[model samples]
Target chain A: MATSIRGRGGIGPALPLLTPAYLWLVVAIFLPLSAMALFSFMTELPMSGRDWSLTLEHYAAFFSSGLYVTLLWASIRLGLEVTLWCAIIGFPAAYVLARVLKGRAREAIFLLVILPFWSNGLVRIFSWAMVLREGGLLDTTLNAILPFRIDIDLMYSYPAVIIGLVHSYVPYMVLTCYLTLQAIDNALIEAARSLGASRLQTLRRVVLPLAMPGLLAGSVLIFVPVVGSFMEPRILGGRTGTFYGTVIEDQFVAVFNWPLGAALSFILLAVVLVILSLSAPILRRVQ
Target chain B: MTNLLGKLAAQAVLLSVCTVSVHAAELHVLNWKGYGADEPWAVEAFEKATGHKVVNDFFNSEQEMLTKLRTNPGLYDVVMINAAFTGQALAESLIQPIDTAKIPNYADISGEKANSPMLNQDGKVYGVPWVWGLTAIAVNDKSFETSPTSISVMWDEAHKGRVVIRDDAVEAIQFGAIASGQNINDIKDMDAVKEKLTSLMPQIRTFWSSENDWNQMVASNQIDIGTYWSGSADRAKTQFNLPVSLVIPEEGAVAWLDAFSIPVGSDNVEGAEAFINYMIDPEFYVEWVTKVGAPVSANEKAVAALPEDAFNRAVMGDPKVADRIQFQAPITDEQRKEYLAIWQELKVGAQ
Candidate 1:
């Protein structure tokens, strides 16, 4: 351990490199987390909103809790759905960009894809609201064609949330896949063609595999945050259904149960870790 | 499985850092959105009275404010909570009881608004009475073609798909109980409420959860009538040229009082109290009343000083709607559970 600490260079040379990160982790992440964990093992005094006894009641409550589990499952399901849809839709657009667009034109197209991503998340969601509401853009289009009135409701439903998530994440997936696809040597494809390999076969055998790393990274970036999200579900998800975000929010807000909220949050973190660990082997094979 | 992560760049660890700060010259307050703007006259007066930086943050709901408190125990020194939530927050010892002696300004507030049976419990005050409003029948006169005076109008089949009620299950259930001619206040028997409201749920156009949602629905003329606060109703009428009118149904309405209090974990207790004291001054109270036009229980001098139109808008309508508004009292735990259970059923049953 001492050797490991002293390591690749003299201690004096390495100390500056370690100091800032250590200070940051301690002040910003670890300290709050430690307080949260400590509180989870304690009992809050009723009406005080302050902890009283150092017990495991919160953990006990969480382990046997049906609400938390169901909400967790719902959140995971939504995350996976978002990830699958982003890839399916993003793949075709990314292919056209990577294989077709070149040089300055490609750069312009890339900026166009990221432009909407720069807008505030809330602004983008509400802009969709104007299109999806009862008398909104889609409604206006549908009304102009029909002979009579047909009221079709789409707002405040799961499909609305799905659309919002897909819209938000498609850009991210495209950028990742585009970068990976751009790095492929044109000579490799020219050689494959000369060696009697078909276009489709070359894509399947070479290009797709090369781009897998980008796909994996983008999926992680989108999935992890979306799984624990509250705003998207609250704004776009139908009223009849909710996710883990709502449950965690309620524990803290309605019930004043911070310890439970912290415990539930960590539980979500563990589940995300499990998912990533399980997928690592597949990611490696693609690489 | 391999698609789990899409490669882009270095992993970004988002650190949403929060720190507790204390300042003698500045005071931070958490209040309802749009309630903090000062009256032109009051602004000039308050600056002269106290040399402190007064700032405010708006929360969407009482629940949102409480969530901020839970995340960082001492993040906010003062928060606005309704009576029902305040009792629980006080009981949890999450909030500090108000010592009126420290706030001489509080003494100037009228006994009716300050020491009302609704604002006072067990002789220990935990909040300063701020504003009062009620959830009543907000009707689109264009739909009814007649003035509305009862909650039963929301149940009419003719208005199906046009009726809008608060998305709050508890409030909706209480309306169901009242419309069905049962006790609206003590919701001990939820079965009766569910039996009555389950049939009415389909009639609802949308269970609006926020002012924005309800406003948009009303603006588009999708929903014609519903229960809403006077402030929201007035905004819809004025801004969108909506034909909506707030009515105190013959069955009466549930009155609400939102008050400000210091959290028990407050780092700057003295600053918070001084801020709270500043809010009740006749100058600030009059300004708040003029801007918000919500019913306020304040010193007789403050109430007397407010524009008559503003005071009238808060209490009875210009023509006097009703005098029988009932406050939602802090019920027993059994009552709370009953409300929650009935609420769950209503939530599931609402389309």
Candidate 2:
């Protein structure tokens, strides 16, 4: 009756607890992806929904088709710009949250930071369009008094999409970076200050290096989704230079080629994985 | 022998009468939002007309409607798709051959310049004609001191950055094509199209993607001149106190017709045909066309019913204006590909 396996060496309790997460991950994530991978390999009817023999032509078309290449590259470039801008803006904001404000004030400011993101992405983009368009708020009210135009042509350019994307995802960056910067000991900053370092030097020498983990974390979180976004570019960037996400959407909806859509999705998944792989070592170094 | 033959003939007549008395059927219908938004009314109409219960749903776009049809043959009885989808839909055999004889009201169909298949290649009458429209250039008369007659002013370089057009691929491309004096349909030389489009891209303040986008652009005066559809301008002029005009350009416009077609699906073929016939009725066609801010095409009676102002503004049977307007056409897959490719180069060059 005495199953006294509470002994440390038995190792039986840990396996079962860990097994469920692995099982859950496989069932929820990997299994559906496996089915999609199977479908993507099969040939699709030109416009007759889905039918025919299995083939690799869709994959070939994705790479060999020049349109796909331009779009994919444009999306990558847009994500990089958003990520870079988010880091620049978010890091300082995050550092301030960690270092300057406290208690209700900090929480209130944090809520304000994320409150705008709670509304729909589509609505926010439209409002931004209202500001950015000519004779718009930025132009009529702001640029009228300025030396130059607000560059109305830029509303549908890569820059507009980037600005919209950066605005949308900056909160994610701030929160992640704030969490990391918070984990850094205030004692270290005090020590740096005690050693006769200025506030700027304390930030650079003590706070910045310690906060790298959160910065990298924020970058991955923002960049991956940014790369996948179609609506931002389609609405703000005018659908002329479609991102990778829009291409996948078109294959399924507009073109009625589900297989090609699936293949493109998997390629994007591969790209995400490669990015993760490349970033992991640098992330580890940050840690 | 005469008595026996008389009894057999009487029995046959009785059998035919029995079969006609009790049959029940349902029809599947697809349309845009707010169109079949009044489904109960349509259901009542269907019951009154054909003694069949109508099951109707709304599809946002032609592609979704056709996708549903392709996946499930004999599942949907009827669909209302836009004009731009018809060419490819016809070529792909996604649309069925309709028995035009059943739709007695087909002869009354107007907007012949836009909706009628006689104007296009492979002109098999698949889609029964529905509403062809006047969702065209709307101007704020206050914004323009003089009455304007051209779509060119929407892209004038002097107006420079104040210009606007829709963010849609085909519509915006058409605006550029019109500006460049290029054929909207046959734009194979992409370099020329790109160069032309790139020129316009700078002039445009916004390439509006949705109905809301165009409305906001005009209402706020974010854009002074733009190519916009009518339903939106009608709302702004009537409701928002925004003084805007929906113009017919001197050069003409590319217009559309949303029509009813039975996609390759449907269990109730007979019922679908009856439903299409029901929509074409003068009473049903008139309310829908006017309510949805569209101009009616199917009924002579409906055009006659419109108030004097709406009629004079071309909702009435104006053959001359209809003849002159350039109708929207469905591009081939090859053409669609080419158009988008050039559009990309245009965006990059604009930057």
Candidate 3:
């Protein structure tokens, strides 16, 4: 590890090479984050020409108001639901691609799975509306074939939002899990089989543990954006779509309350950090 | 080869210089989708008539437009704002008074429409009146045996699970206020409005944000009844062959007027004024209303020029219908906060 840190030379020689990337991060990430933090403490946007003072009223409002808390909880639950669904659906598909499938068919199928990522995300979510609404393509198609007629009015519901989010984000899980699963040696699995270990036992005890990093990476990737997503929920979930992200969006776009939005965003960031810290121990152990 | 390359470079320099000068003269407008100015050939005509090119941006809500105008001053030369927002715009000085002298077509605007309290505030014309419409009930005729003419039709049990409403806080609260026999402009009791909205919550299939989404839902038979703009309901009926029709309910509908204004810090005021003048022209107004299917214009000549049956079907044509409309008034900051809070609570309570 010491030699690894030392690299070809020492820290001094590497410093110059790393400067550009670190500088870019400072300019792009750190600056905006710092500005957002500062803005969170303001009473109003200074540019709005309102008589303003630095106040904690914005943060206090978050704690004082039950609505914000409820929405935040709803958003957290949505993230958890979407991330769980992505994992449940994605892991098996990745396993099949990495282990069972091979060559040209695997390549083509993998491309097909991730082809959704190439299209505009908003367009894809809107397309789901065409299929999910009452008397929509799904309803019409199912009614045409099914023995009994049933209404399939799913649009503007919670399930619609989840479906849209999962569709948009499942590709991330599959791609990550596939990379890690493919790296696992075939000999290890064969050895486990030779030792009379069941496939389920090997999967639970061996494959899962090794693939934990990819799973965690995918979870984090999916959860963070999902928590902050408002557009998908708005387009799909309708009135039932109101979440912490949408509230923040309303503050900025609808209410013109940038300071309050910044405050809410900061609080969300805090919650996310806490979640990441809590999960870090298990993730490190698996690594 | 070197001589040829040098000549090409010289030509490139000349071309870029011309482009830069033309770009500098461009007028940037922030408007709503299909709000009179960007129909089919509006922008092209404007560009051809004036040497200045027109760049357009769009916003769905008045609040969104306000935010854009507030944050990025001078970015937009012309903006189409609602009557409800003109007061705040004036107070904030986000927009400036139009020079009626420069816009000769301002004479064509009917006295009654031009003198609306929204367009002229404190004796200053802050906005050029454009299009006006009513927020009314859109119901599929096939859904009801008899035409439902009341706003209470939304809360009717028969329409439950098949009704949609606009996802706007103020408008939603207004509906509740109107239903409960309270003044929508000045709410004496917030709890009453809350109770009214909450009671109707179960009947609503969803609250839609966009006119397009609401219209499509109604057109496709996904929703049977909803509250939507007059123009969109008309479009969905005529264009999409939907059985949907708009009716001004007995409880009255909210009236909104969109007008053109030059932003405070705009350098291209002349270009913006020219555009506004062009918009109110009788021929342009007729063409705009025809393409857009909106029933009202500030210009009297345009209304007269419309087909014979158009007025009979429009809210503005009937004085009784027009008088009943509750024109959206600008809310105070405290009131705005209250309205939004009430809306947020309504959402949470429903969940």
Candidate 4:
């Protein structure tokens, strides 16, 4: 259709069709981002009756306070830890679904793996709170069958945050890895095996390298959002949940510091872009 | 037959147009859920009698409300602002002073509740006190032998890892200020306040931001004692069947009053005042106040109308409850920034 349309009018005819979508993107995405950037430089919101002035103080405030840097580092570490766990857990499950599992069982299990995506993320995180709190499902159930009692107070702890985040994001990893793994030809694996490559050797040399793109894609998907997430950490980490994202959340809703929040958000955006650019070489290899 | 049907349709449309013209005013109310007497019957009756439509929008917190009010001027006719922050709203010109002439029921407000510092700012009335409650301690009866006598119990080593403090930056820092025996409204010593707040970090099982989180934590036995709102504790005990008892510790507790304020650029000033008047109507306000578990009815008639036992349970009945309460005062901007900074440091240090 594109070729026929081009043959008719050298792309001018298609411009009208594409303008609406591009215009929407520019209006919806670009305009708000630009406004946020502008707001970050302002001393006060114009809506507040205060006389406004452009200043670098909002950005400078980040550097002046060591606390913001520490929180940002903490959020980065959280994203890394969560992405690592997702990869570790999801890659194996994806491997099983793509290779070891077969037919109706595989399909049913695949659906089960992705089921978390269908429910409300907030409600799902809340449900994890129910299961992880002390004397909750995990503790009571373990005590019910076991010979001895054990206490489990995972809620409001670091592990609880990790568990909640991994549960929320692992599906992306599994879905991505499965898509890549399924596309791998069976004959190539057979040839590797016939050539006397051990199962572990074939997996390490062929499977992993072949699957790197999906893993990288999944990592980026999980890492970016997790770094900016406040809700999960607030609900699950409790006392331990103060990260860059939560602080930014506080600045807007709790502190009523819009300029500072915008500055922090813009900084996060820059960091994400840099990270993406750094990973672009490997992402290119995946294609 | 077609001409007759057409004539009937025209008459029906004319009747609807006449009805629409009668109810020409709309008051956009921005408040927390159930801030007003929003019962269907009360709303319907109010609409019918006043010929004004009340459209309500909700926000979760004071800061959230301020953000919305600032960003969208003229979007709201009336707003429910925490009494403490009414000054902030006025300073920012987000709200305008109330004309008591427009709200004749203003006379119905009790003198003391009317004199609440939050309702009047810079010698002008910017807000009308609506719902007021105590910020006190909620103790699990199963854990405490007797009612915990003091706020010091919150920092007692025995209760470490079993106490839930509010996640609010200002409140958390103020708790520390109070712990250090500093006047909560006047904290001149920042370093000392920070040290005092950091000292309590170890005792916090978690810092809860939402009432639901606090409720679940207390009711599920995850927290033994907590810095909780009076209404929340009451519901946990009565509704959730939790073994929780409310107390105002010896060190005093933070109390808050949420009030109605007209936004700066309200489109329907008369309609807004009418709605505010309707909110304090003894019959409607009583049910509304009871439903929300708010302890105080700012209206004198509503207070008189409450059952004797009900009034006793309400914070208003306990005369000493007022003596024990330190109403939250609007903090200076510098203090606000310092409080958040210190709270952040405490949070990070605790981890």
Interface RMSD of every predicted model, in angstroms: 4.3, 4.0, 1.8, 1.4
**Worst lDDT 10-window in candidate 3 chain B:** B307-316
Model 1 chain B weakest 10-residue run by lDDT: B13-22
Q: Which is superior by TM-score, 1 or 3?
A: 3
Pairs that collide, model 4: none
- Please give, for residues A1-287, the per-residue lDDT of candidate 4 as tens digits: 87898789797888898999999999999999899999899987787557899999989988997988898889999999999999999999999999999999999999999799899999999899889988899989998999987888899999999999999999999999999999998998999999999999999988988898899889999999999999998888877988899989888877767888999999998998898998798679665
By lDDT, the better pick of 3 and 4 is 3
Residue-level lDDT for A119 in candidate 2 = 98
Q: What are the clash counts of all predictions, listed in order?
A: 22, 8, 0, 0
C-alpha RMSD by candidate, in order: 11.6, 7.9, 3.9, 3.3
Tell me, by DockQ, which candidate is best: 4
Question: Candidate 4, residue B330: CA error in Å?
Answer: 2.3
lDDT of 2 at B138: 72
lDDT of 1 at B80: 78
Instruction: Give the Cα lDDT of each candidate.
Output: 0.70, 0.70, 0.84, 0.83
Ranking of candidates on DockQ, top first: 4, 3, 2, 1
lDDT of 2 by residue, B243-351 (tens): 6777777676666767777777566778777887788776775554455444544566556666657742453246666654666777665555445545544554454
Query: Which tens-of-lDDT digit does each residue in A1-287 have in candidate 3?
Result: 65876886688767888999999999999999898898899877777677778999999999997899999999999999999999999999999999999999899989999899899988999899999988889999999999999989898899999999999999999999999999999899899999999999999978998888898899999999999899998888876888889888888776767788999999999999999999898779778
Clashing pairs in 3: none
TM-scores, one per candidate: 0.76, 0.78, 0.91, 0.91
lDDT of 3: 0.84
